[model samples]
Target: MTAEKALLGCMMKENHLIGDTIIKAGHLADPRHQALFKQMRDRHQQGGTIDLVTLSTTVDLEPFGGISYLHDLQSFANVEKFAEYEELVLEKWKEREKRNILTVAKEEDWEIQKVIHALDQINEAKIDDHIAISTGLADLYEAPWQEENQIKGISTGMLRLDQMTNGFQDGELTVVAARPSMGKTDVMLHFAKQAGWNGDLPIIFSLEMPNKSLIQRLVASTGAINRLKLRNPYQHLTEAQKEQWPELIGRVSETNIQIFDGAGQTVAQMRAKVRKLMHEYPDKKPLVLIDYLTLIRPEHHYGGNAHMQVTEISKQLKGMAKEMNCPVLLLAQLNRAVEQRQNKRPMMSDIRESGSVEQDADVMIFLYRDAYYDQDADPKHLELIISKNRNGPIGTVFANYNQFTGGIRDAHD
Candidate 1:
């Protein structure tokens, strides 16, 4: 190890290990243990958003990134931290529970003490991404300064938005916004169908529509017919529209898009579902497509201003995108102010009360249709305006939306 790493390691071990530090900082030297500390490092790499039980799982190596150091390394018995002792004990019990100690011993037919040693080695000493961990995390955040992000490929999704932005980049909080009756839900259905069917990914958190309704739209979109038109016709339907349903159903049944349609959910519940998907699809980065932002409610314990609650929620979504290294397409609502404006085009300042919506976003696109204002509108165009982009030029891309088919296709210039 280099001189700096050696020093960091000693500080971590002495301050955290052998002592009863109430609060300490530094990453576990082992990369294998990094995943365990993600939530803590997420808030502030140096400190904050920490879990003692999670940190204790790793070897007491120096924590990395930001302005990290071991400032509070005294024993829990220290006069200053007497009350913290109770908390630490509770955390210690949880850590013990995590070992699956009883189950491991039974499986291996080994003694409890032997299993304990094995557990320590697996949880603490082992490296998650050994090679990467060995390097400083500061190295990770070196800003792509020395390099560029070369995404592997465009995702095989049906929606052209990924094509519009070249697949959601890592570390970005992308927001997709539109008004009611603007084909927002239909677009989401089409997006989910293409993404889930073409790739092996989890299409998470469908917050806007019912599961069955989303499915119907996907099937209808794929078939080139309006879901409502086919399900209920005024008099007689063309023979062609009636025939498209079977073909559409046959095509969509094969994709693996997952949905969470169990009533309204707290942000905590969404996190749990996303975590489950990440574990299940470790190879592919997770994609969370929340139908509409206003529908999301943070857990009850979350306090303070409502807008601030939404802001924190946005940051967390960005954090999730970064940690999972996946494209998150969260659908958001435009403030009624957009309706108040004569232009009706969205602006960053007008994404409701939560300015974080603008700040946290990596890419922001507004869905607009002139037809809503006037049915005589020709070309039936859907305008996708890139209000913000960290990478790529900002502009509008037009696509054709077949309301009758629930279909959105790239429009040729």
Candidate 2:
């Protein structure tokens, strides 16, 4: 209340301050303050005087302790600390809002996701809605230029793709879509491996595969071991491979890759988990990966509307990426329409329920392996068709892909 009184008093003393203030009537807890602030704002908007004399005539000050209360408020005014007072009022309002949200959530039996979402919305509201163009220009001018061959964003480990994209940027949503057997999981793992190797945290939300299976695949990819052999090591391993197993396991374990293999994860749940990891590892850059978008459980109210569910999920995922300041690599399935085409390469339209996904993504990469459809084509050749690159060129980046180990490398050519 002191802060509210101080802020309001300062604004009343200097009518121009009311126009400059970010605080709204809702931010003030006192009913009298709220009423006074609203009137002051309305008067200011109407180009009317906002002095005590004018306000006394327009507002019923009798219920608010009359003119004496306004005089007392003036005594609390300190224009030098007006900004500080504003901050205090905002902080108190946030606290009150959080308490109210929690009370409502408990009474309504709301899901944990809904509770977190509400809290996040409050946090989002605090961000500045507008800024000077010079502020952006200053940031660009002050930023150091990227050194030759240096990736500006998180590296995907594919040199060509890195060159094209400068790697996946922070606060960006990169959608990796493909038909089954086109190696969507494999490509996602490749990115995770690269991020982990670069000393960044790679967080995988694997709704399709178990954590153990992902670990095995990661180990196999890193070790250059056949993934099939890992299924039954005793029968498939050679004497030399057996001797190297411990070292292989230790090397793969060194990468700080955290995998959550829960099925039917909501975006809110994934966001909460990512935020926790970020807090835990503040020094490391985070790269969030979700395998297969359709597997994500949408909000209950969306019901059986697949399109609306996908739209909401895509929108939230993009928002989460920006909020967390990380790159989100969401793997999505391409509809069977690509199979119907003469050329099997997937267009943006090939993504199942793609309207929102295509709109939200900063980069949309479609994986195409000719061998998947034509046995005669080179099995190791995989094309990463960058159908959408918001900040760069759109083209294909060829990679050497190992189906056996789920490994990806720069093409020999």
Q: lDDT of each structure?
A: 0.59, 0.86
Alpha carbon lDDT of residue 107, candidate 2?
Answer: 97
* TM-score against native, each model: 0.62, 0.69
Q: Any residue pairs clashing in model 2, and if so which?
A: none
Model 2 quality (TM-score): 0.69
After superposition, candidate 2 runs with Cα above 4 Å error: 1-128, 140-151
| Whole-model alpha-carbon lDDT for candidate 2 | 0.86
Model 2 collision count: 0
Q: In model 2, state the lDDT of residue 22.
A: 58
Per-residue lDDT over 231-304 for candidate 2, one digit per residue giving the tens place of the 0 to 100 score: 89999989998999899888787778999999998886787677657757879999999997999997544448
